[model samples]
Target: MATLRQTITNALLMTAVVSMATPVTAQDCATPGQWLTPGNQHAEAQPPMGWDRLARQRVVLLGEQHDQAAHHRWQLSTITALHSRQADMAIGLEMLPRKVQPALDQWVAGELDESQLLDRTQWYRYWGRDAERYLPILRFARDHRLPLIALNVTPEQRRELSDPASHQWTLDQRHGVPVPLAASARYRQRLMESFEQHSSEQLSSHISEAFIRAQLVWDSSMAAALANASHQHSLVVAILGLGHVQYADGVPHQLTRYGISDVTGLMPMAAADACLAPTGVADALFIAEPDAPSADTPRLGINVERTPQPLGPDRLVITAISPDSPAQYAGLEEGDQVVAIAGHEVRDTAQVRALMARSLPGSLIPVEVLRAGERRQQLVTLPSPSP
Candidate 1:
């Protein structure tokens, strides 16, 4: 009944209203549950391309930023997906030393419960990260009766290899680990850059060599473990730090020397990184939405490193303090030795973190710092850590 001009105007008005009401989709790379190639190319044509590639590989490495809950979630989901297709799969973990293999075996065999397994593995002593973040993966392996492989060397072995003196040791004295393959030039350069970023300028200059060797030893040990596991299982999935998986230069490099070439590496990228094109960091990157900040997670906001002294004990030194943090508010400064936290004597940064994890939000904990030969105690109010 309306004129042609009026009908056309109404249709245009409706189209504009509908478009406005519809949600604007996020960029494809940033979209949750999507997979992007190492070159940041969309793999939408084959939704299962990532999974198919993983299924065909002998080893799959899933990397994570230790503190990011979202990274861990992606790892579990990927593991779950791979496991559904590969029942003969095994999981290799960098969280536990080879000394705890018995514990892992017992855990999967239903001989030990969660707490008992942690105790036997000395979880708090070696791995100080939140155990809850990794427990779900362990539980999955247990429920499915999959073998959990311990892929890390003992801390003592790591320390021995980190020293320049270990370079002279024979095969027998090297704790059964072979001499590591020479690092690629790119790998060495990346390690140097990382060392500078994490260490103080003075510490960086003096300890760079040792630090680089330590990382190499870590990579070599894990690769050896994975190689051994690969021979026994249809597939092996390795969960480790992102540094070891990125660019395939860390563990992947060592794996090749161990005769493992069918390896794929995957990592989770934050949505904020969606705009940047990737470059061979991993085989595929999953876009993970950042987790909502937790109000209950206590944060002290300080960077610390344990320096082994020739004397009584290792000193836990504050290397940097975040601005407006509890450490800064409580007058803690760089070079201040953290003698105690929550009234307990602390020997390493791990112990400090363990002690802090016990406190709740709004709790006032006492911290003792020795500054220039003077011991001072301050009460610090804990706050939620930034997401």
Candidate 2:
């Protein structure tokens, strides 16, 4: 079986990180256009040549590298520009799942403040990336009274779809998510290359098939949400991770299946990759300098959620762990229930963040976890702070 990091990297390979090209080899992707600007330095001063093209589309997707504050800023600026010409618009978010959409609606209706929305949505529990980076965009939507549409399926839904055995469920039982259209031959080959990039065998057909199924489930779910929301609003602008928008193979392809064809995808390209961008990566690209790591908060590079225990209060279970992270290096795997950190019991992600933030780099923090009903202990060595 492929590791979680390998799976994630395979998914990300189709994202804006590599311009969603065929493969990473230098020979596969074509060179980027020289006429386009590279970074956000001049973004406010002047819009790109095809800026109006985005406003004309019924749906415009703005892609981002989830952790990059600069990408968010670019998205905000692009959104501000699009809203000027188009008054009737709704913003779709991939961050919050459909279940928490009521919270989003309440936020837009002026019934909730920032803290209230965060609490109601369980923002930290669901989307553990820095909420501060996304608050500005959320505030913009709220202030303008723009309809905020949740464009993602629940984690539970994704888990069900990942299991091939669960194919017995009908469309109604699958929460109305259609059976994903078969992936294009080209798209499948690209995904196959992604799996190979993760040090897996070059011909791992089973892993590729599973990975493609997972990707299809996500793309189709979000596409269905956006397609339905687009009918009510003149324009729907979706803020999603680059992977979903890249090369128009993911969500875009799925959207066409839903009869929503007038769409555009705008991806933010790092300045360093300006010349390396592949053709047709996105409808538009904004050059932005990459953001530096956060100095204020230390990271364990793990996403966790609180799980109700039949016998105990609640357990913090690791949902995902980033590749090459301190947690991964320490042998922490997903499904491990975090018991304690630094001798302090951890009940929530916020507490874990607080404890991790206070510890200096290189400090060996003792961690206790429960794996498969067995208690295990590990010490995580934090990497030195980014220079």
List per-candidate RMSD values in Å.
15.5, 7.6
Task: Give all TM-scores, in the order shown.
Answer: 0.71, 0.71
Residue pairs clashing in model 2 are 15-243, 38-287, 39-287
lDDT of 1 by residue, 259-282 (tens): 789999887765445335457767
Candidate 2, 1-387: lDDT as tens digits: 436534553454344444333233333121222224332223333435465666778899998888678889888887888899887999998877888989999999999988678777877656666577788989999999999998877766876786786678888888877778778776676665555565545555666677778778888888989998988988999998887886788899999987888998877765445445656767656667666654655678889998999996689999999999999999999999999888876767866875776678877888899999999998898888677
Identify the runs in model 2 with alpha carbons over 4 angstroms from their true place. 1-15, 18-51, 163-169, 196-203, 293-347, 354-387
Clash total of candidate 1: 0
Q: Residue 45 lDDT in model 1?
A: 28
Report model 1's TM-score to 2 decimal places: 0.71
